[model samples]
Target: MKTSRYILITLLMIGCISSCSDDFIEVANKETLTDSSFWQTEDHALQALTATYGALHGADGSKWTFFEEIYVAMAYRADDQINNTAETYGRNLASFSNTTEDSGPNNIWKTSYAGISRANQILEKVPNIEALSQETKDVIVAEAKFLRAYYYFWLVTGFENVPLVTTFEVELQNLFPEQSESSVIWSQIEKDLTEAEANLLTEHAAEWKGRATKGAAKALLGKVYLFQEKWPQAEVKFSEVVAMDYALLDNYADNFNGNSENGPESIFEVQFSGDRSNGNDERQVFNFEISPYAFGGWELFFPSKWLVDEMKTDVDANGDPSERVYESIFFDDPKSDMYSMEATAKIPYSDVAENLNNPNYFKKYSFNTDEEFYNGTNITLIRFADVLLMYAEALNENGKTPEAIIEVNKVRERGNAVPLTTMTQTELRNQIRHHERPVELAMEFGIRWFDLYRWQRGSTATESIKSTLEAHNKPFSENFQDKHIIFPIPLQEININDKLQQNPGW
Candidate 1:
């Protein structure tokens, strides 16, 4: 029985979040720590785990900051949206001219480590409680381990060689731990996720819906394998997940429909509730239901010309454009009330594509309904379509092109689009490159840039990221030197921890 203390943990954790900018929330609340004498029971353990989940969604409801760091900072470094605005870290990251001192990566580093600290605290404290059954304790610990690995996954992916810490204790010398090698960090992620898979429940009861499960663990472990290019392992893990209860929702747009959240398609979602008084709202001022509401709604993201044109290439068997194009982007539709910040007016997009003039807005995170507006829309992290594509990529990499297209068609069929004909491995690889990932998941978090990185990196890597950027007309491709491959370890970390050395090329 989870305690009413869930609210208490949220209040404490919110104050503890490290803010990127000077201005941040510091709630007026009673001291929670001193009064927390009832933490020995099952309910207390549940509240602690809930706190970890809260940490996942920007510590203490500092919504805009986390998205700015991981989504905007890292996402811009790859070819996705055109560099539209100069505010936040958008232009610098979009141009690939950012530094270790940049606030985006630095704040994310602090937040990521803070999350790890909380998970470590839970792991350390939960086992000692005599009130929890062995079964309950194992499950609780597994959740903590999974959350820890998730934070590290972001850390490792964003900044390759991060200092790894498991225990909550920090000695004088431990504040600035040295950067662990990427291989070493990968091993730790694998170990944590593997244990998490073993101990977590196969399925959660209705009350425990979004909590980590055996399916979530397997899906993530499969992704880790995909990132490392461990094809056969990735394929096997993805296959196991596909056999489970997860499936694609009937409509592509349903994934973003707030009422349709936590459906079978969702492997993991960063849950949000618009409790404005509690400061738990998602902070989605950028994508509002009605444009011209709230200072023009900012309309932060402008879809790239490449994204729009590519989407136009594929239509349904009925010759109508893919529903995803309509669902994912909002252009000059007179029916829509989207505000174009560039135009400085409350107007729909220009009706003509040729004259559209960077007037596109991302609709995925836009309003679903009045009550389920901005702050309440849960962000989908991994979905069944994404996993299917991962499985397809792994299969293609391992000389299984024909079989790979089967999964590709599975996704295409749901969208009512034309399926691929028989093609050689080389041709199928090109198809996945041009049609698959970018179309299925555009402007949905950082998938675009992540795909760009995976395709253009390392010895086994094929295709030129430079060419893709060129094809998209990104102005910064000329200056994106070889060293821009991964983010530099934040300079602040090096200044503090002498053991931390700067990544060579940065």
Candidate 2:
């Protein structure tokens, strides 16, 4: 176990910032030490890894400074309520006309590289630590490789072909290169995850519960295959996860219950332990829920009205309310409490699609326990439910429609959807995309975007992007840009590195 002492050390080493301008590309090379002489011991190696993970947490958690939300938003237009930051990124994707001139894309590019540099620095040094056990060293290197692969995956997902940096040495030389092909980038990702699975322990050692495991590496590999539409390979990987011993929470809502941060269902989640007394602003998820009640801005990701209506019309055999449907959606109806009840009464959405906004905006993240409205809840990345759905998609794509439905209906049965004996490929696909996804993975940043990419439904992407802007009543051009499919390199990167070329049509 890397002692919590390292976490304290990282907090103490608050490097000074000379520039605070948003336009500045937070370069990694500037602050990074030029020589690896200081990184020699096993403790030193572990400290560096802690520093990388610590950076994953931002100043007060006010904004996910390290995690790039823009890339995920760009993947699907429909899944998010776009704001000033996301609009710039999505505009590029919707119209597909972004250049290096775009701001949001530039931020993503810079942050991702910063993380890559941190991971690479650890990889380059950890191998030389002779005191550490070979198993320990291998696991640390695998962890760094996993992080690097994650950064590369995000880069490819957003920009398609991007520069792939594997070592920290290159940064010391200020050597930047042109973008590589997506296939080449993915090959590196595959290599890293393959190595990670081989070296990483399958289960988290108690001290390492929140850290990545062999399962995470396998699941990520599965997702990578899914993105490439390699149905057979994807099916095999997802099946492996299904066969794992993980179990879903008895209640669908319990999986995301903030109190159960690392519940049995969570494969991996960004860990957030609330430290508000220390001035931590770790409450965005809470803020999202408290909007209507606290008289703060109602920024809840209201389920699309179309989705809620679909659920109301859907029925299961026992006829109890859909196990997946939450109470926030049902207040207005006569049989339900749409008009009268106060404390738990359903709140009305005021967007253009208010009636269409599914009242069932996920209550999973909605607070039921009496904690500060929005403190740190672990945001799940992969879970048992997701594995089930992916298994369904992979099977469907591979022409095993019956097996696919069986896999899908297992989840549906849990969520209280009537078990279907069969569904046409198109119907199964549509159901998963429209209802299952939004409800199952709502606001789990980027599920909507990824789903859109997989389906090749550009028109829905356009409408979804438009709806978010229009819902905010923001102005937009009538035409969508195809170049928006990928984000632009941050303008500062283009300015600093002469060889770094911009994406098309910025």
- Count of residue pairs whose backbone atoms collide, per candidate: 2, 34
The segments of candidate 2 whose C-alpha lies over 4 angstroms from its true place after superposition are 1-37, 55-76, 79-103, 170-173, 279-286, 293-301, 318-321, 327-362, 368-371, 457-478
Give the best candidate by lDDT: 1
* 1-506 per-residue lDDT for model 1 (tens digits): 11122242531322244668778776634544432453578987887787777665555436666566556765676555765564455677777778878877776677778778778878888888899999999999998999899889888877788899998764566676777998898999999999999999987787677788888899999999988888899999999998999888888878875667777898888776554555444444435522322323544557777777787776788776677777777665544333343343334444334544356656676653443334556777888999998899889989998899999999988887888879888888777877778888887778877777777764465667777888788768887765676778888888888898787688
Q: In terms of TM-score, how similar is model 2 to the real structure? A: 0.78
Q: What is the C-alpha lDDT of each candidate?
A: 0.73, 0.61
RMSD of 2: 7.9
> How does model 2 fare in lDDT?
0.61
